[model samples]
Target: MTEIPAFKKNLPTQIAVLGGGSWATAIIKILSENNVKIKWWLRRKSDVDFIKKYNHNPSYLTDAPLNPRKVRAYHKMHDALNGVEYVILAVPAAFIPDALKNLNRNHFAGKKIVSAIKGMIPEENMLVTDWMEKVFGVPQNMLAAIAGPCHAEEVALEKQSYLTIASPNLQVAQDYANLMSCRYIQANPIGDLYGVEYCAVIKNIIAMACGITHGLGYGDNFQAVMVSNAMQEIKRFLDIVYPDPYRDLHSSGYLGDLLVTAYSQFSRNRTFGNMIGRGYSVKSAQIEMNMVAEGYYAVKSIHQVNKQYDVSMPIIDAVYNILYEKAIPANEIMTLRTFLK
Candidate 1:
């Protein structure tokens, strides 16, 4: 663990972190290091009891220390969200509905909601911010999305990581970013919430594709070409969907995120895809990896969303076909090679 930095001059802000995954634990660790008050919600009562008693998450990031004075673990969603100004959504996209089923719009009223989820809603086929806006009635201005190349495993190791907080309201984004920044974490704010979020979702699919190819015994040269083509596909999709003239695909929020997810050893999406490429059935791969790979669900959502825009996303299509349509991984990937330059 890195040295904990001194608290900022202002009073600590009350924030709620939802989910019990590795990412959620990492976020708790970061907030604890910064001396922010955390109300962490986990589904299982046993896990909550363990975290509350031991001052650390028992399942994920067990070695990372948590501040008992500043952090409180809760099994009930209602209790966790109570009196919190900021709420960070770190749960897997597919499980979000079940996790918050007991809560209503009134529970989230006047709160700043930040999505640390990198995937879309599987059932609604909507971005998390969009889903929150429509389902929970969280206004666009109050919703922010976190993007960048940071991984929870590396954060546990105390590696220097950067995060981009995107919201339609820049000032609100900056204020939340302040609570997240610490000795090893640099968080910056941006105004392109939709762009950053859409790109973040798409990058996980691309990472899965990279993993599949690597598992199929494809060399690095081929992966470089595929990733280059993926950038173009992402640009095309973003142009048709969001149409931001000022958005830079080359930034750390976009390109940096895509590259890290595609190649990092810690990427669950890549690991899942690699299993598929190595001849494991989808069910078997999922069983082997107890963790959820966002790309599996994300590729399906992106495929459904792209029906309106009809963007030229060969890589996404290839992944969707393999994962959802039951197309052979080798055949789909081989057919995919013809589409890329």
Candidate 2:
């Protein structure tokens, strides 16, 4: 076993947050409460200008006030990377490649990257960690993931929430966790970097399944069964992919995240699935919501990844069939009922 390094007193104080969505805004909100300097990268110059002038993001989490003195908003990706020791990536999974396209491996050489993204990279079907390693050469010890039952909506309201910072290097995880922890936000450190990241992605797909079932008028009784079964499905998949013997599925990083996303009204993935179950076409639901429902993309990616593992993920199959194959959500879910114990 590798010895965990002691938490260093002098840690990186300058951090950059990439992405302009709710989660990014929420993370900025937490950082604003602290005294550290922050750099924010948003794709739209309009949004960056709006945030700079108004001291708040114009679109997502508009209510969370930002301190202009502490945060410098940048429209260019490289500008945000300059002089920042830590980078927190909160962008949607699909947009990550484009977000970092302008920069090369040299850009991330010594920086610590903390991924707040919960979905896999589209088409590539790789976890953010894997993609980052392949594309940027960021070593495992320098990369970390933030997992949650923590929702950006609740965080904006300053409701108490928990987050698990997972990294192969426990010291890096602990250091990043300290940066994110605030009065309402509690951060815990864990060592299952791959497991936490993979579980985070899998839960989104299961949450979509939950939403689809709910939209089809399945009662609470059935929804409860669906979630319980989802837990087992998650464990089986994780066992094959990461294969950690001591990992606890019931931890806040895994099962807690799954339960909240599956049941919470703020989950965009669930909302997308609900629309599908209610007879809206996938394209229509996507257009109507005007937001990326990551699970829609994730199901296809996981489906491809699972071809090798052959895990018995009935819920995932049901979702993939409905979203990709254009199967009837009601009928597919009806069949899913028989597969779940």
Candidate 3:
């Protein structure tokens, strides 16, 4: 375990969780366990009413019991943001723009922002931190990212999980980490904000590649090689893009995150890849899953971003080909196998 810095004094006590998905519910469960007060934002009035009445989310993670006394649910963003010092944004990356379309810089003025979103903004191809900073005038010191090998389903079950909180400000990161730590969850604080955030997005795309190969009938041996190569690929990209010499790719924030997403039963990205491997068209697979597989969008956005870096990412190319260019999955994986170390 990494040594945790001493908790900073006088950190924000009031916090709001902004989203209604499984991740958001998992966060609420952790906060509830700690006996913290949370103002939660769900999209619909009916969902808010249901959670308030039943002490459980109606749609996602219904089994995770919430403490209604500790949590208040609201349908409007502004209503949820009221009087909160830190806002944890758990909304899907693709929908973040539209979700905050009603508000401006003033809405976010005095709040510290933590992003639990592990994706790029689809329209801007920007990390959530960059999007928030550029669009809302939030400074880097005020932003933090939560990265994980941890999944919402496992968190809901009270299973042990680890999370890394990355930010440029060590004090702020440590302060937030203390809030998230509990008996079942371990929180680590680090300063590699850009690298960790980029890895969070990159791992989803690589997980999709793993899923595509799995769906194409490849076994564990091939997967082992692919994951190894994927790690090297991630290192290569982050080195060129973020260039931190001390960043450890093997940490839970990076490699562990890749392994879980690549193989976990709850991985929507892997499931999406499996469908494509089993002969489902991209549209058909997406329709069937009824969830946002971040990799489907990440592949395109990352591919475009990589053009400036010109990194050798055959796996990313293969996924982009299969997902966006209509290349057959079997053929793409066969070609991909030749490039893996």
Q: Which candidate is the best by lDDT?
A: 1
Expressed as tens digits, the lDDT of each residue in 71-160 for candidate 2 is: 989998898989888999999999999888889998898999999999999999999989999999999999999999998999999999
- Residues 1-341 of candidate 3 have per-residue lDDT tens digits of 97655674433377899999999999988877664679999988999999878999999999999887788898988988888888999999999999999989988888889999999999698999999999999999999999999999999989999999999999889988988999999999999998999998988998888888888889999999999998998989998989998899998999999999999999999999988888899899989998788888888889989999999988899999999899988988989989988
RMSD, candidate 3, Å? 4.1
Q: How far off is residue 107 in model 3, in Å?
A: 1.1
Estimate the lDDT of model 1. 0.92
Answer with 2 or 3, whichever has the higher TM-score.
2
**Which ten-residue region of model 1 has the weakest summed lDDT?**
2-11
lDDT by residue (1-341, candidate 1, tens digit) is: 97656664567789999999999999988888775789999989999999888888898889988889999999989999999999999999999998888889999999999999999998799999999999999999999999978999999999999999999999889987887899999999999999999999999999999989999999899999999999999999999999998998998999999999999999999999899999999999999999999999999889989998899899999999998899998899999999989
Candidate 3 global lDDT: 0.90
Off by over 4 Å in 1: 1-9
Q: After TM-score superposition, what is the CA distance of residue 106 in candidate 1 from its true location, in Å?
A: 1.1
TM for candidate 1 is 0.96
Poorest 10 consecutive residues by lDDT, candidate 3: 3-12
Worst 10 residues of 2 by lDDT: 3-12
- The Cα error of candidate 2 at residue 184, in Å, is 0.3
Better of 1 and 3 by TM-score: 1
Q: How big is the RMSD of model 1?
A: 4.4
The residue-level lDDT of candidate 2 at 190 comes to 94
- In model 1, residue pairs whose N, Cα or C atoms come closer than 3 Å (at least 3 residues apart or on different chains), thus clashing, are none
RMSD values, in order shown: 4.4, 3.5, 4.1
